[model samples]
Target: MNQDSKNKERHQGRSFTNETLFLKDLVGFQRIKYRYVNVLGMLAGLLIVVQAWALSNLFAGLVSFNTLSFFMLILGLLAWLLRSVLHLIRDLIASEASRNIRFNLRKKLLSELTFLGPKRSVIDEDAALSTRVYEQVDALDDYYSRYKPQTFMVTVVPFIILLTVLPISLITFFIFLLTAPLVIFFMVLVGHKAANANRKQFSVLAMLSNQFMDMNQGLSELRRLSRVKDARERLSSSAKAYQSTSMGVLRLAFLSTATLELFASLSIAMVALYLGLGLLEKLPWQLGSSPVTLTNAFFLLLLAPEFYLPLRQLGQDYHAKQKAEAAASGILQILEASTSDSSTTQVHLKDSETPQTLMLFDSLSLDANKRTRLVSISGHIHEGERIWLSGESGVGKSSLLYILLGFEDSYRGQCLIDGIDIKQADLSQWRSRLAWIPQSPEWINGTIRQNLTLGLSNLDSASIHDALEKSKANIFIKKLPNGLDTKLSELGTGLSGGQMQRLSIARALLSNADVWLLDEPCASLDQETAEAVLETINRVSEQKTLLVVSHDTHPIEWVDKHWKLTKEGLYEVA
Candidate 1:
């Protein structure tokens, strides 16, 4: 008896909440909100009557041989029909409620995630994140729609069965009541241990799946390092761990199943034992010969075994609950992280034109890593002037470009644009108003035209070609088989380093922003080509607010002002 009670306590309290995991635990959430759960509760109460009526009549042999038996069956069909329709309706409502709950919760979690992204939560490998979002979260659908309602049905069914039986026969009723707690006791105790095992297996599976996804993403890197065989071995180990744990769960589950059946059979056999003796006149009442009259004992006999059927099911569902618990814990961690970040700091972006200014530093410092710092910094430029920042080797020249680009996390003072703070404004919108082309900008698999027309509608292709012609990019595109529409493969097979840079400049020129932040605008070019590119930069910077971070010491001399970054700080040199 104590053992039965112990099992009951194991599944007593499993919680799933927090914005992330809440969506995954929709099954539990729906039961709490089910307005019709009470109505379903009443149906569960009526089920005892339905079972008694159906089983009693079936045993009574009211439908004797031939047409006489058939007549009795047709006449008694109404009672069976009531039972069928009620169960059907109850099941349908539970299914619908579960579906609604799961969908709404999933949608809510996704929306919250959107509000906190790009920097809030990063997916190192998006494939795993996406799989968890769709697949792992999908594991809850059946649980919500089926197992959740079943949980309630399981809880209410046994007691209702006991309640109906007690009035008809207290002796048999107390016995049913007494042994049920014992079976349930074993179920809870063993089921708790099984749930824990299932939890561990599920975690390992999710981890394994995520790791394999990452392995696939970095397949190229792995291949280069000749580590593909090692990666596969690791995956195999994870799979084995999952399988071993799952088998352990299955073993516990079989024990649970056998235990539920054992106690249930024992209880029903007692009822049968009691009734079999009653036939020999052990009790005061005599056994009826009429099918309906004697049918009572038969239905009672059938119901004994039926009462434990769901409890038998408890083992498998306890595992499902275990899976839900695992998924819930993982998702909750994500929600807590997002919530904490949101509560701790209100992130106002860098483009809001607040009182704080967003001007360029006189000189910005740079270095590769540890030894990198400011060496040459020159003074500021007004709204319309085009300034060029230049320096020698190992200088903080490129670092100056990062400072203006807003990638650097730390800077000595504020950069103000017209007395407005750069940090508060939308950097995206601000970037939209300017063109930036780094020395070696990355490219995707696309044509030169696609790179230029990216995110822009109604762009003039003629202007695109003109910008390309200026950067000498048009020369390479024209040489391709498809000309401007050539498909650049993933690894950039068709274009040279110089050609890629030229296309980047063309993209920048197409943007036509107020300010052009050009870092090493004419790098990695032959002497003659570098001269032409510099000529184009001088022409383009005339009306634009250009801040050129360059390593060139050419003769043209068109820079209106020069800022040098030194150890002292940024100051104007020309």
Candidate 2:
């Protein structure tokens, strides 16, 4: 095959895989609830047949015998009410199932993100990730609540109607069987195109969302650079692209609905024609007489539309299935990326009464893009040692800290703590023993107390005050209105860089972990502030093992030893 054919084949394969994954998740998440939805659907189908039979009998009694049967009328009304009730029940069950599925899916996505941590950059764009977690997950609501149950109804309800029709008129049954395929044929033909269109629409939506988020986050920079107009124009272009693709999907949906309706109408019309002719004794046959009675004719005519109801509904819901498949593709990619490496051992790292020692035996790290981040280098940090590690820009100084913090594990060689290789140890337990203070600290839009005591319970007032004083953040924090109870904006927007850094240090101090991994902790501070922060860190971390990666020489005097990292290897600076 040529290149175009090969590409088409690959695309088709990917679509199929996405569809399979969606089905697996649907069944796996709420198998019992989904089964109940189908059971209700089947019961409703029987009720539909009963309602049609009663209505047909009621009409036949009035037309043929010139007499009204109140019994038939009551039976028909009761069946109709029961069928409606069944439908309502099915919808309620499906809706609950859909909500539960979305909840579990979001939880899994969040867990994966938490597990990956900094390595979640492999997911490409943060905006795209948010879209998957929110928008894409919401798109599956209709698939689970409507399309899934409808699929079962289309299969079971039509068969029940067929069995009812077979005894009344063979010709109607044959027409039902044969004409059903045409509707399905057109549905499949249109649906293939709709599926591709939905996927494209979702892709464009993700790109547009990512671009909009990026622009929004950097609006100040755009204005300062005099590129606000350019950003606006680019955003407008993406919006137009998304609009075009969305219109394409809507067009395919309309076309599929119309096609199914045309075929369904023609088939129902044919059924009506046959029933009318037989009732008038006009059907072409050797006997030249109607084989179907007046009551049976009424029954067949009343049941004709019911036969295609499921098929029509299925066509309408096919678009939802397509949307869900597209969304599942993105979600599954993230979940799969999280579990791709399950070979890592789960041995829990037990906390030792003695101080812990960290050893690196030629540890190396490769980034998500397969680029060498940390070269083959080996070193050891004894307990209670405050080592200052200096390296040039892009020399993997932060990468080394990430490896020790249990965030980046795509490395060769061993990172051992107390003779236990970290790769083989439980990351959750290992991380619980380490305190990490990144160069750019992050805080949620919550009270300062919440940010400081995150995940650390039972921190009394004295402990909080002690931690803040030790990090030199108490003076600034005390001046703020409401003190620690004062709320801060996202990323600590109300505070200066130095204050945020100090608060981060205080938060780390509150963790009371045995090891401290400080990645350029003072990089954002001035000379005086940096010196103060380093001095505070040295005093507080006197009994803890500290590995501080910085380019400044302020920590050189206080640190036990200074190590310099180069492309060649890690070396001690005498």
Off by over 4 Å in 1: 1-48, 61-125, 221-225, 246-255, 281-293, 339-356, 359-574
Report, for all candidates in order, the number of backbone clashes: 41, 0
**Inter-residue clash pairs, candidate 2:** none
Top candidate by TM-score:
2
**TM-scores for all candidates?**
0.62, 0.90
Write model 2 residue lDDT over 40-107, tens digit each, in one string.
88888888888888888888888878888898899889988988898999999999989998897788
lDDT of 2 at 532: 77
Clashes of 2: 0
Candidate topping lDDT: 2
Error of 1 at 52 (Å): 2.5
Model 1 per-residue lDDT tens digits across residues 488-508: 754456576567667777777
